[model samples]
Target: MGEFELIRRYFAPMAKATKPALDGSGLLLGVGDDCAIQRVPANQDLVFSVDTLVEGVHFPLGYCPRFLGWRALAVAVSDLAAMGAQPVCFTLALTLPAADEAWLEGFAAGLAEAGQQFGIVLAGGDTTRGPLTLSLQVHGTVPQGQALRRDGAREGDLVCVSGQLGDAGAALEFLYDTAPATDAASLLQRYHCPQPRLELGIALRSMASAAIDISDGLHADLLHILRASGVGATIDLAALPLSPALRRIKGGAAAGFALQSGDDYELCVTVPEQRWAAASRELQQQLTVIGQVQQEPGLRLNADAGMVYSQRPGFDHFSIT
Candidate 1:
């Protein structure tokens, strides 16, 4: 099929599938337009983020198309969540070696499912022939002056993460055949389909002093907050949350995975000590306090043996071998 025909059949329906149900909507125009028109609600600011996923680098060569569709958009939406913004709409730019009908069908279904789940409409984008790659730009909104920022953390604030970590990293071992068999399904699900913590972010808008989505692993992502906020942190190795599947791995590998494994997509946030009670109550069982911000200017890990330093904290595109 032609490019326009492909879009009409596979992508156009996604635009309508996720149209906001609320009144006074911001999406004035979506797909099929040269440019999307959006209106920022009164007393709110628009938050924007873009993410790109390359075929071999981001996922396996023969990865599932549907999961790729969902993950591509979900990764970008996680950025909005870190800012404590509600997702509004998104644009997609897809590059493909060829337009295979079966692949497009699965991809469209997954993309639409994510849009419907997140209440985000497809805005406008482009498609071209090339190696398989997906780039998504997402738009969200937060009440003026209430958007959580990485630079807002302060000394004495408690650092917390939403949900468990290291599952996705452990899952990667199975995918790459680097580890013995365990529970592959649960781990793969965490790696393939990441659930952005949008609701939790919204709840913490008034409570969190600083926030960041842990796309690049806890150590690296937390350092971002520290640098941006001009502070340091002391994280307890024992406090890192690990999934049952991850913990089952032999030789106590879960700790290393939790600290350095990327693609967990959980939010790492800092809450003021005074607001910890309210924040923890709002988050309920989803929040885990793993550390505290400090007046010093470096990341310190409190381990059972003693204090430890991290040499490599996360994935670096250029540095990856």
Candidate 2:
């Protein structure tokens, strides 16, 4: 199919599928237009983020198209979750080496599924011929003056993370290693289809002193909050949450995954000591207090033996060998 035909057949339908959610809403015009028009609701501010995933750099060259479609959008929307914003809509710019009909079908299906799952609509986008790449821009809405930020953390705030960590990291390690292992399905799922913690973020809008999604490793992403808020943190290594699947691995390996692995799309939040009870009650079993914010201006790790220092923070795009 030609470029226009490819878009009309696959992408246009995905945009139209969101019509029910956008009808008479903020989305004035969606796909098939020169520009998508949207109206921000009163007393609300719009949040925007863009992310790109390139084959061989972000994922394996022969990765599953469906999972790639879901992950490409999920990572971008995780930024909105960090700000405690409800998803509005998104635009996808897709570059493909070739318009393989089967691949496009699976990709469109996955993209549409994600939109439905997240309650976001595909508004508009562009398609071009190139080495495989996917770029997505997502928009979300949050109440004025209530958006969560990394800079809002303060000393004495309780550090918390939603859900388990290290599963995705473990999955990556297993994929790259020659180790023989059964029952990798769960870990692979975690790596491929990350669930963005949008609901938890919304719930913490008033409760969290600061918040960030763990797109990078906890060590690196937490430092972002510390640097922005001009504070420090003390992480209890023993307290880091690990999934049962990850726990099946060696403890030291799991800890390394939790500390240095990226792409776990979970939220790390800071709650005031006094507010911890309330936040804990609100989040129920999903929240785990892993540490505390400190007045000092660097990260410290509390281990069983003694305090340790982090040698590397996270995956640096420029520093990757």
Candidate 3:
């Protein structure tokens, strides 16, 4: 098929079927127009998430196309996971220097695999010629009044995090500087293919008052929650979770990277003190308590003289760096 024809046949048809928005019956409007239409069911909340991956910025050249496709979708979906929302659908926009049949095939296959895995359909998107960039906007839904928000945290709530941190950052370090170790395979995988903690988010909806995804490092990500919730936190420096691989090379430094390097995609959540035990037990496989919410309105790290780690900010797309 010719390029435009291929898009109309395969991509356009899919978009028409997936409607980005919804109808009166709560059915989603996925793919037919310039924008997607979707429905938020009665008594349900809608979650919207968008992420972009640039060739030179987000990934290095020569990175596998299949993995890039998967990572693009996964990164967007991680926001839904942070909100305790059910995967619904997504729209993709691609900018490329040129189209290659083999590359498209591989990319589509990877996107298809992730779509099926996450129960999200590719509803719509645009393709253009430019520097390689992939952007995805995803929609997820949660029961009415059940989606978690960054502003719902309360003072004295327990602060929690899902899964190990720093692995992705450590992996990036290796990806750019040196060869990855045999054990570092998992870290590299974590960097490339982070699994959004959707299951845990669903489980925590009722228990967690506030939540945010760890995309721009824990310190910055958590600040969103703190600012919104009007609270502060005291994280134990000794308690930051590091993968076994990360611990081997740079011990505490890895933990620091985990705290500030960004792109972890783990969920940082806050639950009332009373709900801690139950939340912990229910999400034991996916969560761990890192600290507690403070009545004070400032963030602090575990250190002598009450050190604050928010000094070194996380990645900002607009930063002058």
Candidate 4:
């Protein structure tokens, strides 16, 4: 079959498998359109997020198909996690070089496994022949008025992060430069198997007014929230969390990696001081307060003199390649 034709038949149809059970009689529109339409459920705010992963850019070419699928969905869902929304459904669009049955099966299985873990369903998507890219649009639902945004952080709100950071970026370096060591395996897993903190997100729905998932380096990702809210942050270099595995491998560099490396897929949130204890208690499942939002409007790294540094500014799609 032709490339686009194959996509229309197989790839496009895959997206609709879950809609029958997810949407009521009002699906509005599915695939094969310029845009999709759906009725926003009563008492719910529709949350929208998109993420894209390239084959070589995001994952190594030898990366496992199942892990790739898992990571792809997790990356998109991470955005929802940052928004403090409950994942509802998602659509995938994949562009591949060829139709390899084994690869497709493994990829689909991995995506399904992630869906099961997160209580989300595949709604719809599209596929086409190209270099190789996977883009997912994840839809989440929150209380009618409580979907967290990146613009609501108030001065004095605490900056919090879910999970340790930099392991993923460190993994990338390990893949190319270092021999297979104990830390290499763990770091690679961090890059391939991202866990989106959906539970913590739902719990912080009302407490955190601003949030964003760490995709780019922490410095760059936090700048997103800071820019949106017209605020700044003072991230305690000492408080940044580092996985024990990473610390063993990179030592003091782990903190810098945690701050500047991306692909953590962890949620960074800002909660008011009054709600800190309650929010922290609830999100103890997967969160930590890393810093504080500042009245000043610029990014600052609080640390001893001249010790702070970032290896790379952040992941920049346009500039990287």
Model 1 reaches what TM-score against the true structure? 0.94
Better of 2 and 3 by TM-score: 2
* Candidate 3 Cα errors over 4 Å, as ranges: 8-37, 176-179, 304-311
Candidate 1 on 41-148: residue-level lDDT in tens?
888999999999998899889888899888888889999999999999999999999999999988888888888888788988899999998999999999999999
- Could you tell me the TM-score of candidate 4? 0.87
Model 4: per-residue lDDT, tens digit, 1-103?
6655655644454445445335362245666677766656667888888888888877888678999889998988888888778777788888888887788
147 Cα displacement, candidate 1 (Å): 0.7
**What C-alpha lDDT values do all the predictions have?**
0.86, 0.86, 0.79, 0.79
Worst ten in a row by lDDT for model 2:
17-26
Model 2 / residue 2 / CA error / Å: 1.3
Model 4: residues >4 Å from true position, as ranges?
A: 1-39, 176-179, 305-308
Clashes of 4: 1
Listed per candidate, the RMSD to the true structure in angstroms reads 2.3, 2.3, 3.4, 3.2
Off by over 4 Å in 1: 18-23, 176-182, 280-284, 306-310
**What local lDDT score does residue 165 receive in model 3, on the 0 to 100 scale?**
84
RMSD of 2: 2.3
In terms of lDDT, the poorest run of 10 residues in model 3 is 18-27
| Candidate 4 pairs with clashing backbones | 15-124
